[model samples]
Target: MAERRVSAGRRRHRAEWLRWGSLAAAVAVVVVFLLSQGQDIDVSYGQSPASSDAVAEGGAGELGDVTVPSVDEMAALVRADDVVRLPGAIASWDERRVREAVGDAEVRILVAPPGLDEDERDRVRDVDDATVRVIGTEVTGGIYQASADSAVGWRAQFAVGDVTDQMVALIAQLRDRPAPEAVDQFDWRDPDEAELAAVAADLRATGVHVGAGATLDGIPEDLAASAFPDRRAWYVVLPRQPFGEPVPRYGPALAELFPDTPVVVVYGWWIEYHGPHAGDFDEVVGASFYAQLGERLSLYDYPQRNVLAGYLARVTDVRYAGLFDRPLPYRPFDPLRVALPALPWLFTACVAVYLVLSARPLLRRSGAGARTGVNARLAGLTALAIEVSGLTDVSGNPSLTRAIGKLGAAGEALARNLPDRHVRSLLDDAEAELDDTARSLGRADYRPDSYLSERLA
Candidate 1:
């Protein structure tokens, strides 16, 4: 009897030590995480390999083995003989740096426009091979061209049945001169002479170079001569495949007449379709239509600027100048990665400790633990409500608080042998609150007071 008692006591003592020790370890880890958190990855753009490796290591826990090369590393990819392609809109070229980088080598600047047919693309390719080496998808090239001929570069007058207010104002501003001239309109379906005359007058009043769609006879020799009298290059906007026909074969004439001067042809009607849209922003970002190296490093706005800077740095044997716009913030290391994986074991330990400590009281009044059980049930429902409703941190919801309180009260009543109707009523009210929250989340009405949390929650 004495030996058995001693063995039992030792087992209890060992079990007690383990429960407390496990709880202490978990608490210590959580406390340490809270004390040292919110650290961000520090990325040094073209810093040394060691610094780049540090950035890679910083986010290794979150991103998992993703390593972004530094600007210096990317610079090594560009060869001296490679033609650096740039978007025409980007004018922030450091002339000295460009000259120093490539010496006498020439680079291509793309100006592809929208709705470019295969034939048009081929023509552009011919031009590109001679000048710019065209490489990229149709959409990418089109976006590159669109950025080149942004609103600021509009010089030609366009006439359509439904013209935007911006287009009208742009036409007026571009053509408005000392002498009143008419801007011609061609109503393709009706072919209204009076309406066309009126539209022409309105456009000409602003001193714009308006075309009278009178003769599609190969862009009248006189108009060509008049337009390019100085024999200088010009980015001209031509009518869309005159009279809904295919683009006229004017390349031969254009090349012959302006062999010495480069004439870039743009579509007058293309602007009508390119309006403010979600996809436009993505296209612009993908176009990369600016110098890679600039004062600011924005891949969306100016990829070419950075590329140029990188090229210059490579050739000049100078360090990359433009790295990042701002310094990155510091972040704390997360222990959750380790804790989450061992959650089952940790939870089991916690429950064992709780049952062991409260075993006597639990045995005396089994219903005493029912309130904790009820709270746990309510907490689960509240979590579901939060997840479905998209709430960030809803700690002070009156309806939710009332529901939880009623649930606790019902649990106490059940403990005293009361009826289950009170619990049913509380459950109904909680369900109602969840339904209301879901309804609010689904409403799509756009109002000034509408917010993500309010609507979703």
Candidate 2:
């Protein structure tokens, strides 16, 4: 009879475990389904247009009167792997142009100058007319990379700054070329002839092919052509002030004349600065600006040169290497992306509650101090959560630390109700561990590596 009773108890335990497992699986499926909904609402990966379709379908027509780089010119640049600088206001057109220009070349699109209203972003996304693989436009400055199955990752790469330099450096590394040298010292106070001579001499000395010309109106093509003849890429220096009249004509003229050459326009009030290094330009920025611009040039019909003016400072200031280290994949209207912060906490809370409720009967089977066990179990779970949040270093780290203190209070209350000495002893040990962990967290000296080490080994 005793043997039969033991067998029956074993069957009951297995049945209970099976029931709990099924519930857990169901909860997991629900959470996953909710998260996956983000990908479904995004641009369909299956709908990515072919390069021929992009070129034939044409995105230039949508750009109104904007000046577009010639497809042949773009192809040559792509073939030579040269970087072209353009404007960000024409990003929609640029994206399309890049798609058409590279044919089947591996490319990455990173949308930036974040904090645009949702409607504005949606409009921009719709007009760009290509499936974006990553969205690097999060307010927290993270990259949402696309996973192997093309699903967006839940966590973003935590980083901030202008990614232009990193992108430039990355391109240089990829192409096996040295970092582009900067020409920050230019003699802007000299006479027109003297200034032109100095610019030409600087270009020759550094082997840079970029030209510093007032405009294409009277500047000799020989001067511009001679600047960087063999490289097939050209740069022009533009004036920053009195931009209302001269600027419009200046842009179109370059596009019209050099229909085959990739152009980068460096804008500043060059003549105002009389010092020796007065007309200097940040080489990294120039290289990065052109590289990014080149990559996105295919989207607009006409390039607006200074749209990234406000962003220049921030972009150049980014010291973090992780910002553009990976590609950010984003979907339009992803509810999950917007609600990232609250989701993890909500899921943890719901699961913890469910487990406590589901295990109520088992606690009662002990026939004494069942309620105390339930409370103790809850305190233990809460302490674990606090420890995890402290270790992970999320935005909610402070709140999680405070929660540890609260858990300690609750654990003490629950332990006082326990009648058994051994049970109380175990509860005391657990509470002591929580106290130590909480103190470490409070000191802000707790490293995740050490916390992980304790758990793992």
Q: How does model 2 fare in lDDT?
A: 0.35
Query: lDDT (CA) for every model shown?
Result: 0.33, 0.35
lDDT of 1: 0.33
Q: List candidate 1 stretches off by more than 4 Å.
A: 29-286, 289-352, 357-457
Best by TM-score: 1
Q: Name the runs in model 2 displaced over 4 angstroms.
A: 1-255, 258-362, 365-419, 437-457
Q: Give one digit per residue, the lDDT tens place, for model 2 in 1-457.
A: 9999999889867755664554354346345645555664433322211111223323323233323234454334444543333233211112333334344645434343322333433443342222231222221112221111100111011111112333333334444456443211111222255544554454445423233433222223333333223333344444332311222222234444445443444443111111111112333333343333322222222222222221232222321111323122243575655665665555455434434443444344434555655454544444365445424333333344344334433444443554445445544454455445446556433333344345446
Residue-level lDDT of model 1, residues 251-289, one tens digit each, is 233444435543433333222111112134323322232
